[model samples]
Target: MLGFFFALPNALPADTRAKMPGMFQRTINLGLDLQGGAHMLLEVDLTSVLEQALENEKETIRQEFREADRLRTETIRVDSENDAVIVRLRDAADSDRAFALLRDLSKPVDPTSISQDKTTRVEKLSEKDFRVTITEANIADIQKRTIAQSMNVLRRRIDPQGTTEMTIAPEGDDRILLQIPGAKNVDDIKSVINKTANLSFNMVRKESNNEAAMELARRPGSLSKVPPGAAFYPEEQGGGLIVERRTKITGECLKTSSEGLHPEGNYPIVNFTFNIRCARLFGDLTQKNIGQRFAVVLDGVIITAPRINGAITGGSGFIEGSFTLESARELSLLLNAGALPAKLVIVEERTVGPGLGQDSINAGKIASMIGLAGVGLFMWLSYGLRFGTIANIALTTNIILIAGALSLMGSTLTLPGIAGIILTIGMAVDANVLIFERIREEAHLGRPPVNAIETGYRRSLAPILDANITTLIAAVTLYFVGSGPVRGFAVTLAIGIVMSVFTAVVVARLITATWLRRKRPKTLPI
Candidate 1:
């Protein structure tokens, strides 16, 4: 009963057991271990991750400590090696107060506990000195968010998705690993991932008001105001961002989108549906300002700024620009992928080719079919048809759960990943065999059928968990260390082990329980 409860959650649900209207379970995906293709390892550049974080935080810090500058000019510099921000005053008059502020920033580390000299503020500061250190927690957060965002963004950048299988996940505290089985045009991925993806909405600076612009510009970080009814267009890779008005609407308003042609001409356009919340905001903005042009900017460039013909209360609109069909599709994908919590830097990249990925898929399929057939035949030969059929039924359920899980995760199955699935299939029955053998032994020892079947499952629980845990450790370690297909193999294998444990222990037990209740057998076949 304990084992059944423990494993039940992992098993396939009643509804999932039903295959698609016509398709069968045997025809599913196979990963790259059995199929061969490109296998490459990628590491996220944490150096860049920390640098971006520092760059973003630099201005905020200056704002916070701006008052302290009254005593002397002070600046905060990030020391990447030590992962600490060093604050220095132009002169010694503010050093004491600087240290006091530093104390306030320090949470767990007490500044007074450290040795200090009367001559100079603590000679050196380590990562422990900072309030928020770029340790695993910080790195983990950046890694996870980056990977998830990158997945959606990259998928968007690629149109008419092909037979490419790739896995992206956190490799370590500050690194991400990407694996592609048939990756060929790796440079395409590089181009996609290397972008900073920094987006902003600011009032465009007008050249006619050079004096005001220069004054605002000279204010160091101040943004310039746009001339009334005028727009600013900066050249390629221009110095900074400028907009006419604060964006009344952003990408968040977009609920659904589709690519289409503009009504007036051949130019590409993106039609979008906005949520009710945004619909109200947009309606008010458009209704209030009928003649204003709203800039549709992406990244930093002004993509389009259509004039408000009238108040749009329908919650649907189109973005018209001098875009081609391809560009329009890509734009729609970016909008659909959603906004990022923080800007992302591409530290790694890879691309899988359809040709290579297809070949790998074929190989993986052959290997999986071979593995399944071998396991099924062996089980039938070793055990009688009755018991063997039941084991195969559980194995089928295990595979379904794995497939459903992969689909749910939106995970791409690679070649080595297919090998993992095959290995899982072979090993999944070990628990079932253990339980069956235990039942047989009990039957031979003259125990009643009901007691023997229940006892078999109850006793096998501990050994099952112990065996799977050891393998899980190896799988997790390989997932961290090895790249590409290796990680794919690890992911599928780990998932399979979990699914197998459930189907073998719980699903098989349920079937046996139902059978025992129905038959009420007096003598059991050993």
Candidate 2:
């Protein structure tokens, strides 16, 4: 009954099969080698993470001095070459106070640990100059955390439903491995994974004009002439818009976002709702800066610059740009997934065509059938009709149980996994061969048929267990140390070993017992 339940999913269509109860719905998933999919190796830009950290530290220092009257500094700048922040104090007398404040802000190693692994080290460069270097420990910790966060964001963006058989895991220190089985659109997946999706709202510079912005945007040489505290960003449609460097709202403030069509123009747009605090803050900003334009920035490019006609208190707004339905939906999906901590570069990409996968599956199926038939024929010929038939029944049962077990566990079957199944056919019959030989010896020794049968099973049990256990250990080790197809092979090999033991010892023994009771043979077939 359990075997029937497990095997049902393979016979029904996916939609109809899913309607069944959970216990009966599980089916063996095919691996990428057997099912077409996209394979990608992404490397996280760790240098960007460190640079962003430095910029954040610089901003924090600026904000700290602005908030604290006692800690005053002339200038705070990030020195990329030195990988540190340089702070110039207005007065040398305030250096000690500034250093103390910065030290207090440094991250502690742990609450319970006595070791002091400060995030920053403040060194006195001169009377008024101080150099703050980020610690190696902090960089390592940030890199680790950022990679983990990026992987999670990538997973959410690539497999929102989580039903697709996808694997996203850390490959190395700064690389991630992604495998999606049966993926049709590889480019779309790549685009979704690569997008940083950093969204922000910055007000337009009051003194900046479209003429100056356009000139700066068109001619790279005119960049130096652009006004201070303002930068030009390419507009979505065309031209450019100059906006302030400081952002008033960021993507983190967004509570929800969805794709929708504009009410007036009927063009696709991404509608967003902000959290209560950001909503109130946005309302006040719009109310105070009426008639002024604010730029909606996505990943540093200005998507739109809409003027505030009146105060907006609803906390809801939509971004307007030249967007198709698909692009708008993708944009909303990214916003919902949240932004990645660092940029991801595609180090490697591979796509397996469905036709090729089908070919491999067919080849594996043919090899498996050939192996099974050869093994079955050998067992039937070596042992005469009744005993050979018994061994064949156990062998057939072994295959069914292996399939049922794989289905029950939801294990992926790769090409190599099919090879494991074929190998199991021989191993299953090998145990029966040992038992049959032992029975023949007992019969030659003048033992009764029933006694010979019982002794044959009892004497062969230890050796069979010893051989399968050793192989099982090897399969487990392979699973732990290997990846991809190697792991798939390990899964099937281990399961086959287990099922073979059951069918050989228990199933075959029961069949022999039933035959003995029904026929009451005077002499053994051997």
Candidate 3:
């Protein structure tokens, strides 16, 4: 009686064969392939590689200058546009000596080729001034490795998706090529990776005096932005810029974040909660600086610079940007997704028509109906009414539980996933047959109804659990090792196994127990 109540939910309504909403509700998730989205292959810029290598060489050049102590005559500068380092003599008398130092400094660098240009000019007092310009050759050395690092960063940045099936790796020297399926909006993804969201906080410096500007530019701690030339424009909201050292707490530490109206009641805001560490730091910062403005900077721009009116030790804070409701929600998703490993560059894109998605849904539904009908009919014909009906009940439970499990796990169920569910229906009935046959044998031996039922189940328990346990082990292994669609199959199989056991052993036993208690029939049916 109890089992019937439980089992009834699994059975389909007689006329329509549709599931009850409250009994089993499921939403199908579409795969990238079936849904028709963009596939991407992105490569990182390799020129940044050359610049970094040159910067390293600059440090070496500085050391050599310090060692010689003759730099009252020479200056070293990296060209803003090109990846070249220039060493020039300031005093005409030190030209030859400075050239000697330049050679020594550049000796460690494996320059492929070297060339020099000489020029002479008459000084103000009519003295001849001569200078030598040399160009080093090892410009192309770092290209391959730089691209490799960029590919790695891209891989790291994209890891938040937790997609093992998608490939993002290096191709060859100076190129990174790989594919991610089902991702629409290639431009959006490209924007994420291409935008170097490097942020920093630096104290504002006075720009009044030339000497001060020079001194500030020379400071080891201060980073200077180049003045606008023909190619670039001046900073709109200007002051100082250095890479913002991230807060001890980042968006990653957040547990849950949502968009809402600000408590002060003016504009849209994003409310976020962080773990213990973030909360402690945020609370302290808010408490101590009750009136000072702390900038809420993202990517680079100072989006919000609200005053710290009070402490916020609770690990919750509002990101009140110039965000509309939609943008606020989108930002919330990005923060919730955690930070990307590097940046993402979308090298591919496409969109699927609604017609195609609808076609897939129809095909999947028809296939499911056919598979269910075939399985149900076969069970009835093979086992006869009483036994077959119980097996069908168990099969029905298997489907319900699979749907419920999918919902709980937050997995999207695509067409391949639906195929897995249909497969599970056939597989779920095997255990019930094993137990039923064991009971039939006991009843045929002329044992009393109660003794036969108990004995049959007792004997069947070990084999049934062992069989399902072994299958479960395989299912779990596949779930971890296999990619997208295979994983769906594994999940359905594993869930069906557990649910099959419950419905077959527990539900069937309850029905049998009720019958034995009511009628106490002596003759066996099967």
Candidate 4:
């Protein structure tokens, strides 16, 4: 009865559902095959994962050699062609020491394994020079982790509540299978998933802000080398700014983010707050760099380069760019969920239409009525009118309970789910059939109607429970092992089985007991 109340909301119109409580607002979500939606095959950039690892290692080498040995930044350069970092020491005598340092920093390719293959392979390029290349095992491990993280991040960004029934799974070595049901706009979703959202604040090179330097940076083929720990990031407005690659605070420090409008301009902006630890860090960073300017970089592009006139002790800030209302909301949504591990390139994109058209759905409804009517008619003919009427009522109640449970659980409904519902209708009466046959046998032995009904129910209980329990186990197994439509079928079928038992044993028995008590029939109807 409680479930029936919950199921009632699904029948209401959208306007009515909105007026009801949140608990009753959920209707069964239709899958991509039933409702038009976006479909995408995203290929994870495994190479970008490797490149990212190399960038981190490059930073480590730059910091160590620059501080410890006073080595010039220009001496250490990334060997992009060879996929390695090349370091040149000022003193030839420090060669052995630097090699030892590199070896010490190198970790096992897989920390869980003792395979002896190290992540970094350091070799002497020349006297006072060494090359550090990432091992194949480490590259593969990084790629695998990227795919896993990408799937999780995508799930959180697209379907945080887990009710959208979006499918995000590994497709191949370096690809993700993505399907968003009822998502009308493909481009919008693509934008949400594609952003790396790696936000950071870095100090700008004071000299780079000058007109001559700014013009030089803007030239198409200037061929200027960026400073060791700094890169030229293009500002949102027009020019470029050379900013430090390292940051004291990163996007990982953010606790929450929301979309808001700029106070003065009323332009859309993303407001962010940091956790306690990062709050103090932000305070100290701004306090220390009060006279200098810092660049807010997102995915390597400088969004804003505002001078720190005063310290921001509050640990909160807003991100502003050329953002529309929709984009700002999307940005905030991504920030709250967290950044993607690597890039996702949409290699395949399309919109899927419903598998069953409106006419086909109408036909299905008609066919369902005919089938149910036939089943009810057979039950009425086989058993007497009173008992068959009770069985049909129980069957009807079982379906309502199934739908109610499904709505409450927020499971997606598909063609396979509808098939499961039809299957439930046929199986709903199996318990009644068993009990009825037993009652007929009891009547043949000259038992009274009351005694026969009691004996039949008591004896049939064990077998009915045994059969339902075993079938329930199989349905659960299917749910666990399957994906997509198979899981949909399993979900509906399992819920139906449980509801069938309730209506059969609990509901049918109650009605029959009351009728038997009031009427006080002497002879068995069968």
Candidate 5:
């Protein structure tokens, strides 16, 4: 009864549902495949991820060598082509020590999982030259981690407002599948997800000993091949700045950001606060570097580079670029959402219109009706009216229960999900058929009507339970191994199976029991 009441809203028009009470207003969300929406397949740049991982590995080697033996390295550079790190020792005699440090940095590919697959394979090329090759297993692990992280970041970036049912899930080894149900603005959707918004505060090189930065800046190249101690940040407006390679503040440290007007210029700005730990570190960085400049970098582009006039002990600061009101709010939103680990390149894009979606919905309805009617008619013909009526009642209740559960759980319903429901309608009668067959056998054996009915339900209970349990296991496995609409189908099927068990075994039994006590028939219907 409660299920029927909750499922009522779905039968009404949009205007009628709006007028209902808050609790009754809920409805199952239509997924991207069932509604007009944009579908985008994005591929993660594994090259950038590998380069970043190798750079991090190089730094780890440098730190371990310094702390373990105080051994100085002449050069430690990432070989992107080979996905390896080569380290040159200042003293040839420290080769063994350097090798040991690199070896210590090596660990299992997955510390929590397998112990056999190593992350790094360390080898000494010469007396003073050593190369640490990142194993393929390690790269594969990194790809998984990067993809997972990017999915999380993309989820936040894509739907901060929570306006629609959006699907953001990993597609393959290096791809993300994004589906925005009922999304109209395809360009806007693309723009938001494409923005990496990786923010970092890099200290500007005012006076540096390394002429590599000067030489690199004069060359005017990308940030990847800058000097060892400096990073080249190109401004969004024009030109570029050479800043310290080491980042003092990053987007990860940001606690929150809000749109605000600048104090002097009255222009829109993004006011940001660092987390507790980064706040202290940021304050110290600002205090010690007074009168120096730092570039506010976003996605390898300089947003602003302001000079530190005095000690900023407060953890809060504002970014003032040529931002309008909307852009400021967007920047703040992006900062709060965090950064994507690797760039997402669009591999494919598609859009489905509402006309096609309505056609799908109509077709699904037709198929479901045909299936339900055929099954109910067959049951009515095979068994007597009394037995078939009870079975049909249970089947109807099963569907109501599915709808109510879907509505309450807020699960998105896709075309595949509708198929699951139709499949479930067919399965709902399995218990009844078993019970009817058992009752017929008992009646043929000369048992009384009430005795045969009781014996039928009792003897058929084991088979019914076994069948449902195995089907439930299959549904669970499908859910675990699948994503997107596939999972939707699994969820709908699983829910339907549960409801089918309830209606068939419980609801149908209760109705039979009521009839038995009232009519007290001398013979069984089956």
Candidate 6:
């Protein structure tokens, strides 16, 4: 009865399922192979993460030097190819002082290993030039930490509500494996993950002349020559714009975001609010730069650059662009989930259609029915009607118990799992066969029916336990060492092994004992 209630949800209609009690509504979940879904392999762009870190380090160096009155440099640049920061001192005499200051600025390798470990080693290229190369150990550590953080963020973004049975796990040092069951739209999930969603506001760099702006735009390689503290980002609406690299506000300050319609244009937009501290800072920024153009940058593209008409002190704002309703909602969802630490590239994508899944499920059902029928016929024919009927009853109970256990545990059922179930049916009957043959031997020895049955079960206990335990151990090992479909097979095999033991030994014994008490026959049915 408990098994029936537990397995009831799978056969009920959607509306009927909702009407059922929660305890009776639990059902076994289907795997990607059974129900169809999306499979995605994403690789994190670790190089981009390193480059961003280098940029931050460069900014820190500039700020530290600016605060120090005596330190002076011609230019501070990050050499990505060489993986080092170059500090060109204006005067050769200042090299020693600059190196000492910069060395202090570099992070300590370890607080305990101050003397032995240093994050950066300063090398004097020439009297006026010094290079600080970051340690390889530090870079590797950053990559490891970034990948872990990226995996966590990806999981949160993909399964925000946590209702879906999805698998999001790290594949390698820089890759993520995603298997989402019942996910119909692969592109939707991909788009959410691919967007870094890093939002920032920066003031547009005012050019001295149109020729300078056009020249910088024409020569993409001349981005390094844009200015001392500015970046070149192409505008979403038009050509390009040179913007201040220093962020006035970032998405970290954002409290919440939602999709909404633009007040004036009625187009889709993302409405956002900031915390008190950021709201005050934003108000001050807009107040000071009323006539200056402020660029809203997402990832690297300039979404919009509009002049600040007046001070925005409401602590809220809206972003308007060429966004449809769905796009606006997606952007809001990404913003609400927080931004990814690094960009994710979809290296592989596979969409399993529901039709294929249905076909596989049908084939599995047909195979399972055939196996069950064949096993049942052999069991009944070999053992006469009385004992054969007892084994059949135990077999039926075993199936129900397997389904009930799976439903209760919320495990997924795959095609391989169905095969495990079929295998379990054969194994269950094998145990009964051993016990029945023992009973027949004891009956031939002139033992009474009840005594023969008792002795047969007692003697068969060791062998039954030995066989099931060995199989269970193998199933457990497979579960721990394998993945995906292999794991599914292991889970079902393990569960079926346990349930088969119960039905074969305890359940069948109970049925035979009840029959013996009712009809005290002089001879055994076998």
Whole-model lDDT per candidate: 0.63, 0.86, 0.58, 0.83, 0.87, 0.85
**Model 2 CA deviation exceeding 4 Å by range:** 11-27, 108-116, 202-249, 252-256, 263-266, 273-295, 305-317, 377-388, 428-474, 522-526
Candidate 4 per-residue lDDT over residues 1-526, each given as its tens digit? 6888889987899999999889988887777767768889999887777887888899988877667654443377788899999888778877777888888889888778869888889999887788999988888888888899889889988886676888777887999988888887777688788778888888888768566456655772453556567777877777788777877688889999999999999989989999999999889988988889988888878888888998898989898888899888878888887889888889999887665434435665676677689889989999979889999999989888988988898888876787788888898899999888998999899888988999998999999999999999999999888877788889989998998888888899999999998999887665
Between prediction 4 and prediction 5, the one with superior lDDT is: 5
**Candidate 6, overall lDDT?**
0.85
lDDT, residue 64, candidate 5: 70
Best by TM-score: 5
- Model 3, 296-324: lDDT tens digits are 55654555555566776777778776789
* Error in Å for residue 71 of model 3: 18
Q: Write the per-residue lDDT of candidate 6 for residues 185-209, one digit (tens) a residue.
A: 8877877787788899888878623
What lDDT, from 0 to 1, does candidate 2 have?
0.86
Question: Where is the poorest 10-residue window by lDDT in model 6?
Answer: 208-217
Q: Count the clashes in each prediction.
A: 15, 0, 14, 0, 0, 0
Q: Model 6, 289: alpha-carbon shift in Å? A: 8.8
Instruction: Write the residue-wise lDDT of candidate 1 on 246-347 in tens digits.
Output: 444667678887789878786789888888988888888778778665556666566655567899899897877666899787667667766443444445
Give TM per candidate. 0.53, 0.80, 0.55, 0.84, 0.91, 0.76
Query: Model 4, poorest ten-residue lDDT window?
Result: 355-364
Which residues of candidate 4, in runs, are more than 4 Å off?
Answer: 15-22, 67-100, 103-141, 148-167, 194-196, 206-216, 220-224, 258-270, 320-334, 354-360, 442-448
Taking all chains together, the TM-score of candidate 5 against the true structure is 0.91
Report the Cα lDDT for candidate 1: 0.63
